[model samples]
Target: MQITLMRHGKPVLAASRWLAPCEMGHWIAAYDEAGVHVDAIPPASLAAASTAVIVFASSLPRAQSSARALGHAAPRVDALFREAALPFPLWRCPRLPPFAWAALLRLAWLCGYARGADALATVRQRARAASAQLIAAAAAGPVLLVGHGIMQRLIARELRAAGWTAVSRHRSGHWGMARYRLD
Candidate 1:
């Protein structure tokens, strides 16, 4: 009854410079080289067939590419797992100063403070809700969800809060692996 959520690996940037959008409903860009390099695959006790019956990813090319490279069969692109849309697209403007970036991250966190809304809170809520749905729908098995960084982090937090045992956070790459042992 465990749900393992892992973030996608390192990707080549599709944009030359960071920019933000001036409005909402903008299409989030995908990673150019989004899959893990073969050499970067990490060792893991879990595989696609083991406890992983369901695989979900954000509706971004990078996420989908990563899932495919990892040999996840029929990985579904779930909108709920997509990264929180920025108030503006990051690539629309010149990169912000370091302090400004930090402030922006903080603001993003605050904005996602509620559930089922297109904010960070909503992403977390969706991840958990999806996980719960899988646990209920699956008789007894492990599930895999390939998602973005923020969504994975939120999932880990929720799992920790629910007392599920999990692996330490793994860095970005094709071989990144994190596990949650749902009781």
Candidate 2:
């Protein structure tokens, strides 16, 4: 069985300004609601979306937009595939780009400061469940999942631990695909 995991297309939001911690909260909310840049989808990803027997997407707007952009019918929307929640801290530091803030906050999250989202352990459990569900679906034919970068990484790790082989690199870029095979 083949499982192709694709990151959703690039979001259409602008991140040119540095964001304060309080501003970051609003920024993340907007980011979550933003859709994808339809013109930026890679050709290979679009083709994979068309050929896969089933396409599953996170309920997030970006993933849903990407699924539709690929000329596929409405995908099975599953919150299980949602992006791991970002936990921003109230740091009294200079503002930074959204990506930079995300990097720092993720590091903080790893160090045991969950702003409020599920703990890392809980997220891991969810990944295991998501991977098992995908594996079961793959029993019939090839499957494609358009989801977020972090959750996809977690799911890929779980799949690897379960003895599945990764056929593609674990890329986190927009439209990047992670291919795995069950031998």
Q: For residue 21, give model 1's deviation from the true position in Å.
A: 6.9
Candidate 2 deviant stretches above 4 angstroms: none
Sliding window of 10 residues with minimal summed lDDT for model 1? 23-32
* Clashing pairs for predicted structure model 2, backbone only: none
lDDT of 2 at 32: 92
6 Cα displacement, candidate 1 (Å): 1.1
lDDT by residue for model 1 over 1-183, one digit each (tens)?
666666676665433333343322222233322444334544462364245776777777667766776777578677767765444433445555433543565476565532223665556678687666545634456677777665676766766776777754554445455677755
Cα miss at 74, model 1 (Å)?
A: 0.9
Question: What does candidate 2 score on TM?
Answer: 0.94
What CA root-mean-square deviation does each model show from the true structure? 4.9, 1.4
User: What's model 1's lDDT at 31?
Assistant: 35
Q: How high is the CA lDDT of each candidate model?
A: 0.58, 0.87
